[model samples]
Target: MKNIKLYQVFLALLGLIAILLTISLFIPEEGIRVFGMNLKFPTIGRLMHPKKQETAEIDNIIVDVDTTFADPLLQHQNGSNGDMGAPNAGELSVKNSTIIHLNDAGLVNLHNFFEKLSSAATAKKKVHILHYGDSQIEGDRMTGFIRERLQNQFGGNGPGLVPANNVYNTFAFVQTYSPNFKRYTCFGGDKLNSRKYGVMGSAARFTREYKDSAEIANETSIKTGWIELAASGSAFGRSRSFSTVKMYYNSCIKPCAINVYENGALIHQDSLKADGKSHIFKLTFPGTPGKLKFEFSTAISPTISNFTLEGDYGVQMSNIGMRGSSGTIFGSMDRGVVAEAMNDLGVELIIMQYGGNSVPFFKDSASVRNYASYFKGQLNSLKSMRPSAAIVVIGPSDMSRMVDGIYETYPFLPYCVEQMKKVSMEAGAGYWDLYGAMGGKNSMPAWVNKGLAGNDYIHFSNGGARVAAQLFYDALIAEYVKWSGKGE
Candidate 1:
């Protein structure tokens, strides 16, 4: 009797397992939601979905992105220009049609800003360009190259902005900080209760809140926040030196002492005001310095927003690269802080490169459209803060996903790029097709094969970043050349 009952129980367990396997086979591969709640079924769905490719060979796949893909706007041109004498301000290139696509409305409005950048060196003025992007630019990959090239062409020095408590070990500049500093960003992790993340969508502090002066004095805690910046030996000569260093900080309740050291020698010591308003501390070196360090000693840690190292004149391109951001957090940051930073830096142009982070999560057409609309709002917010700053939106680059053990371009990447271009144009911003520049569909696999991209088929390697940056710089120069002719 006991043996018979044991056999029945074993059979029941097997039956339950079989039922679960059957349910897994029917679950959505892309995931599903009922009444706005995610079904959390991807783990189960993977048991059956994305059927593994049998005898798949990556080399067998032939990818010719340039031949098959062209920007949608190319068709709309309709041979509008009767005579293509010299490429006009917003004319499509007759050779490749990869030049910056200027919305007629935006070009007319931003004509002066472009002219200002073109004349920055001659005018002996500091023109700032904020290149904001997602993980594609993490560690200043694309932006650093662009900065090096532009500074070599125009006139500038030093890596523009270095964030406090940097998550990515950047090659643009060598930065070391104490481990006590906590990183707070608008997008992820343990965010601050105040939500006062700066323009970079992040800030770092030694403590989360204000501490009583007596308590701080009595406290023997060794927790302190400090950062050091020196020229990375590998960086270009132009970016390896700086004439000025400006630190941006806020949210200090008690006066805190800040120490500045130059080449390990104490240069200056000062105390910050207890006032909670944004503040800028400027230190001008006698000439381009090789190294500088900042040590903050306070019981209550103030939010150290960012630091800018720049030259006396020429174009200053700040690489405000935020990892894993969708470029949508600008709306949530403190507008006052953003406005102050924009005006102080005199940002004349804003180049936003995003959408690669949004590729995998897009479920359908509605998702793409919604993302476009959402991104447009962020652009509008930036415009409102810096009305004089001309905006250029670089659409998503080609990204890949493995399906059936074969890596191919995401099915809707091209669609997402087109929608982004439309909304950017509608929002009175110029659009650049990074996707097309990279050779379009399935180009990531090609880039990976060439060692220009990572094995993940997402982010670019250093060489790939240089290539992308050059393409963008070339497109930008093409427009500037036409604008420069007018000045001549």
Candidate 2:
């Protein structure tokens, strides 16, 4: 009697399993309607046996291509460089939807930039390309590749325009600072009490905080804060060369002495002003130095605005990265100081790539449009500062959100991309669709599957970043090909 009862229970369970398998075969692949409620049906194999979740392994796919030689494509010509071929970045290239040129003028501003680029090697001054972005480029990911390619195509060297106190460990250059240097930013930090943050939207100070004279007296002994930079051997060839270094600072109310060392030998020394005004200290080397160090000794530390490393001539692509910025904090900075920096650097092109930070919080298309509207004002303000400079806006790449236990593209990413393109053209700036180039809807998952993106589904892994940068470079060159009448 017990054996008979057990056999009956086993038969019942097998019957139920057979029924589920039959139902799954007829249901839509996406899901099925059950009891008037949309439900996803599992595959027979999935129902029978579950697959384990696996994380993508971070691979060293980036080859660090030598960017020291000029690209044959960048050679100047009247038009028709034979068959204008598409750009190749080793593995991937831009296809189908190239960079969007919204207006009839298209990339006229950028075309003018190309004129300077063609003659960059012989230009009287170095032409700068300021690539401002958020954490996507915080460690100089996409921007570093873009810089490498451009410098290779044009004639340039060194990583341009680095923050004095970098929060991210960037491969472009290795920077280390003394602990006394306190970081402050215009975007988000404890109130700085001064709105003098420069174009980069941040500054660092070595002075100790004071509550009264007692605090100052207690720390009267002169303390020193130093920042040292050396060419990172892991970086690409061009990024490893630095012949010119410029330091921007302000708010020095006390005499501060600056000593610069090249390869551990004291090369230059100078004293800073006691007046509270913006100042620039330039140190140029006749040849590339293996390492460079700046040591400052003072009773009070001056606000160190920023630092720049560059070649004497050619295109200098500066990665002006802010960790959590949405490309909307430029207006909060000192306009005069920003203008000064722009002019002093001889900036001719500005590439503003953002929107990732705002993706998750965006409510709807209207919200995205509103954000773009505010962003338009910032672009206009930048134009006012550098009237001749061309601005290009790079839309955010595809970010994913977990839906029904699967990572899928955020619903409104395309809407945000369109809105940004519309406003960018309205502001007389060029636009690039990073999302579209990355394989439109539901593409982040594929990138992750290929080990090109991170497991977080938000940031691109090193391999993914290199691919995106290459696509962007290819798109830019394609537009230039058309603008220059090189391709029919």
TM-score of each: 0.79, 0.80
How displaced is residue 27 in candidate 1, in Å?
A: 15
Q: Best candidate per lDDT, number?
A: 2
lDDT per residue (tens digit) for residues 400-483 in model 1? 888656787888899999999999999899999998887788778777887778988898888788778877876776676666
Q: Write the per-residue lDDT of candidate 2 for residues 293-366, one digit (tens) a residue.
A: 89999887788888988766677888877888898987778888888888998899999999999989898888
Predicted structure 2, TM vs. truth: 0.80
Q: Which stretches of candidate 2 lie over 4 Å from their true place?
A: 1-97, 208-221
**Per-model C-alpha lDDT, please?**
0.76, 0.77
Clashing pairs in 2: none
Q: Which candidate is the best by TM-score?
A: 2
